[model samples]
Target: MMRFVFSLMIAVALSPNAAIAQDKPSKAKSWNLTGQVKARFDAKVVDMLCEVSGGAACADKCGGGTQQLGVVRKSDGRLFPVSKNGQPIFSGAMADLLPYCNKDVEVDGLLAGEGDIKIYQVQLIREQGTKKWNKTSGFTKAWRKQFPDAGKKGPWFRNDPRIAKQLAADGWLGLGKEADVAYAKDEVE
Candidate 1:
């Protein structure tokens, strides 16, 4: 009986779920400000501004992936602005959706936000008639291609030389060197 009780306590202590529970709370619980919901639907990619203005040639005027892209759901014609992809901070889904401009696609991801300010975070996508799904990792891949010299680890913004140079010139807070010094002095005192 004593041996059985000791083994059970050891098993409980070494359990993966118990270890994870003690390490840290889930970030998803705090970051879910917009009530994110998993969504998988078929939609036609469109330029949000042009679609709103009734421009038939909207996709043609995406300005080389500079313009914002969105999707119009096939079932109800509900428009969803795709603001993010499966990448980390400062990333967008424009590149992932750019290739399928004006074409029908099946998107799987989370729909978040409220009322007129909703956004879609595209996790996976595929052509409407295709069986294979592709992960929405275009932004990070493009960034790696564009900045081959940047380090492989950490967020792209932190490793970007251009951003670092800009931050150095404008201070960490982007309020000029004088302000940064003033703020630091105030905080220290």
Candidate 2:
């Protein structure tokens, strides 16, 4: 009885299920904000992650001119990642704030999940000392025009065409996994 109890305890302690819970990557099925709270404030457009870890210059290096934009609140300097559905509001945020980079923007939207704002609608976007609210659509159009080569290359061009070309030159069709093939021998199709 003593031997069995000790073995059981050891098994329980060593079980993978005994590990403490860890944060999983956000993979929300529904891309919609919950517990929505209406908020309106002015903040400067900044590159979300880089702005926090590195300074403005490091922020600039991300995504060429298309880094995911966030709002750094003027009052508290709290960085709110502008996102909807748990994902960074990629193109839409970029379209709205590309021209307004490092400039103040008046945001009105639903605040949700960690410091993300769900911008279902735009209230206004104005630079300091400017009464005129700039057009949001033109930011995307201008980006395409300016960086014609980099445009339409998907979110930040991490999957740039040049990389594929290089892979093709090396006689790779860009398929298959880097994992051990032997592990899949028992995986019945």
Candidate 3:
């Protein structure tokens, strides 16, 4: 179809090494490096996101800094972010947000008019293993009252499956749920 062919043609034109072509709105997922929007490059709030290869400082940042923020940029392209600042942009921890880099998310960031791109912050949405839910008015009723003030912070703390497993291993009648964790022992010699 003409649409497919046009898309392919735009893609080819957008490559860094590709020659200039007539101006066209870039495909959402693809960028054109020719003109206009390409000119938007080095312009306000828009830029070509590049992958960072490897280096010492880059290692520490992308590896685990785990911080996200909005930054200010200047005419010389110097950024004030605490990391490598004044230079490093789309790469390292920052580039991890690249559409290709993280496929799980739907990118909804922004391109401000001051030669800087703003990201809303990347988040890992999935957590595995058992997760606890609130209990209703059962034996747990009274527990909800003193839970916040308890040194344990809540019945849930003592009721962690890990904690229960350890207690049972130590010969206690370990209860699986928070409410049961407070059971009054009746067996004694």
Candidate 4:
């Protein structure tokens, strides 16, 4: 019984680290593009500045933004998502990566390994005199104004439309998406 207890203790000690490593986020790398890259997709940065500048939608006319995506262009300047191989599998949270689409990008993310991500460093290529920081924020800022519940069961990240769009893209349709995935998992665990 003592030997079995010792083995169980060791397993418990090592398990957390293993679990952490698996859920770790991956990263990307940045490079200046003089020539054409084979794989370029429409993407953006989901940072707060972006939300203030671009809002929830694509920001087409009046909501013009600084964020742009890296496009794989030919000598004639025609663009494509397919690299030297096949089509690029667009990944990452859209709320986190889509606002910068159609703008020049410099990514610094990981290709493989446990916590891999393909993200942007110099994500935007603005045209001329644009201010660096956004003053008009706090729109999507989470507050307990709506749900004054006693439980820590208060909501989070609801007003932001980018996250909503991302959830929809990820096949999570409505309120039940967050409930079904996160809360349900905790119950099972």
Instruction: Report RMSD (Å) for each prediction in the order shown.
Output: 13.4, 13.5, 21.1, 18.3
Instruction: Tell me the spans in candidate 1 whose CA falls farther than 4 Å from its real position.
Output: 1-33, 56-61, 150-153, 182-189
lDDT of each: 0.76, 0.53, 0.28, 0.33
Q: Which stretches of candidate 4 lie over 4 Å from their true place?
A: 1-91, 113-189
lDDT of 4 by residue, 1-189 (tens): 999999999998765221221112222222332321222222222333334444564444223323332232222232222111111222222322233444443332212213222222222222214434221122122223333442343234553345556877663535656665886688799
TM-scores for candidates 1 onward, in order: 0.72, 0.45, 0.18, 0.21
Cα deviation in Å at residue 163, candidate 1? 2.3
Local accuracy of candidate 3 as per-residue lDDT tens digits, 1-189: 999999999998766421221122322222222231221111111122211221222322233223332222222343222111111122222333211222221211112222233222111111113233111112232333435444454455464455556876653544444434455433331
TM-score of 2: 0.45
Return whichever of 3 and 4 wins on TM-score. 4
lDDT agreement of model 1 with the native? 0.76
**Residue pairs with clashing backbones, model 3:** 44-115, 45-115, 45-116
Window of ten residues with lowest summed lDDT in model 2: 18-27
Q: How far is candidate 2 from the true structure (C-alpha RMSD, Å)?
A: 13.5
On lDDT, the candidate that comes out on top is: 1
> Which candidate order results from sorting by TM-score in descending order?
1, 2, 4, 3
In model 1, how large is the Cα lDDT of residue 183?
93
